[model samples]
Target: MCSSCVMLFNEKNGSILPEYTDLPTLQKGEILVKNKYTTLCGSDLHTFTGRRKEPSPIVLGHEIVGEILELAQNEPFYDLNGNILKAGDLITWTIFAATESDEFVKDKMPQKSASLFKYGHVQFTEKEKFNGGLGTHCVLKRGTGILKVPLSVDEKFAPIINCAGATAMAAHRLIDEIENKNVLILGAGVLGLIASAIAKQKKAATVTILDIDDTRLENSKSFGADNVYNSLNPIEELTAITSKFYKKGFDIVIDMSGSVEAIKTGLKFSATGAQHIWIGAVTPTENIEINPEVMIRKLLSIKGMHNYNYEDFINAVNFFEDHFTDYPFGTFIEKEFPLQETEKAFQYAIKHKPYRVLITI
Candidate 1:
């Protein structure tokens, strides 16, 4: 077996470095996957740059896709349709391993357990240590939600499914009538793009997007955003657009911008009974000032979601397969790098801020 390499914390400072290590042995019901593609997510970059706090000396990539190397003594592994999983099938699993049936687990928010364990976030441990996708192999915890990559979907679409795509699915779970709604997406990143596509597919009346990057906003139109705005000109631009776009305001507001300012701005333009989803804001930061009267007066339904459930993962996989022709999901992977170039890959990702930068193993 090849040596397992992990992105570890440099003891001197908080900077990240890769260290070669031994592979983790799988426990019962667990599976050891040979990671093929590891996408560097915004959260990963944030953790690296000290923008987000994590139990350090951790392997950081969580948007994972890979081949199965060893499956524990269990036969229930299968695709979304019950097709049994095999050794070579490419698969992606949720970032969390939330299987305990205790009340904390049954409360419907598994990602918030007191003893919660997540990939790409926790500190390295001796017992089942290789948990992140940056390593050569990862032992999927017993309760991790798994799904097979459809043959029709290109491999490039695999990594982001677990993070951006699945989160989009989970966020839109309450929206039943997208066609009748005016959708607004903040931040034209991966999550924003995927949400735009999903809203468009549901036949939203109008889709508007906000971002500072002209290129991203321009490209968003093809991804289902009918109108795009530049947040750089904060006050004037937002005021003018909000007044003309929808006199009654937007029916749905999806916030994928990590900035708290967006949330503050979003609350102002939410229509009555609108569903406002908070999917970004992963790191702990200062609280934004907002008027409680706004939410109460608007009668808005506000929801915050982190990782997705098993069903959403399946939906994301199916969406990529079905919508590949209309939206180039693969274009999100702007560049690919070998495992040894992991550091350089992340540097490239931060510097360019491309849709996504993949570290292909």
Candidate 2:
């Protein structure tokens, strides 16, 4: 049995309570982790605003990093040559334990059917036991998919790997296939900064980051962006920067802002044969207008990316180990708090801070 438990619930509007609950026993292929820290994300803000509907009493905060305590006896999934995994390995896994069945992630072929959620839903699973990272400790189940992280990596940096860092790295990996590309990133938030850093590290000729927030723009420069634009009209800023830098549209455009307007603006700046990768989760209710003629004329390819695969997570971790401090990971952090003050921590992340907010357990 666990000593303490905290459950997030929306019994009243904008009110969250961490109620004590029973901690269940761990089963095979599962490991109990003492929650070290979890970071607040933009999605958590959407939840607070009631923009995204969620079932009450649901565990919250998906961006998590913790210490391993206990592990299940079972092991599965091999390497490229089929070797079984063992315990005592520090790793990270996506928040998917309930949907690991054959019906969940199996991408059906011939007819070509994709699963409902590629990483199979960020929802909590009994098998994985900690719904979101809001609680003290979570049980990550094996076969639920986990990636080994370096023990030397700081816990504060771990959560970033699971979500924003992984996504940016994955997008950059995809865009890296094309040679001598100039990339434009829309937004200077944590995701945008991470993406820009990865893009520059991967040899992109130039990286331009756009955001209306001047503070964030300055923050972007610290992360290796060749150019930063703070403007209400990102299109104009992008055009001017491109004219001065590349004198043409960018070879790749990555939109991390997820704003419908940002998507439209990015489309205006996409070069011929350029590819656009969407890492942000745009509002489902919003519709983005696009000209098919422009797409065809520019021969542009637009793709939507979700959570990271194992490779992406590894790359992000490596990136952190090598350059996290040099890029001012410390500068990006706004504040930190203890786990007991999860409410206040989250509120700060939601209402005020943009770069990062962390909770130490």
lDDT (CA) for every model shown? 0.80, 0.68
| Prediction 1 TM-score vs. true | 0.92
For each candidate in turn, the TM-score is 0.92, 0.85
Cα error of candidate 1 at position 120, Å: 1.4
Error of 1 at 36 (Å): 0.5
User: Which sections of candidate 1 miss by over 4 Å?
Assistant: 1-3, 11-16, 74-76, 79-81, 234-247
Model 2, residue 91: C-alpha shift (Å) = 3.9
Clashing pairs in 2: none
Residues 1-361 of candidate 1 have per-residue lDDT tens digits of 2467776654338556667777765667778898988999898888778777777578888999999988887566765467787798888888887766845568756676666668888788666468898888888876677888878877766889888998999888856467868888889999999999999888888888988899999989889888888877766665665566555678888898867777776777787878888888877868876567876877777788887776777788788888877887778989988877787887898888899998878
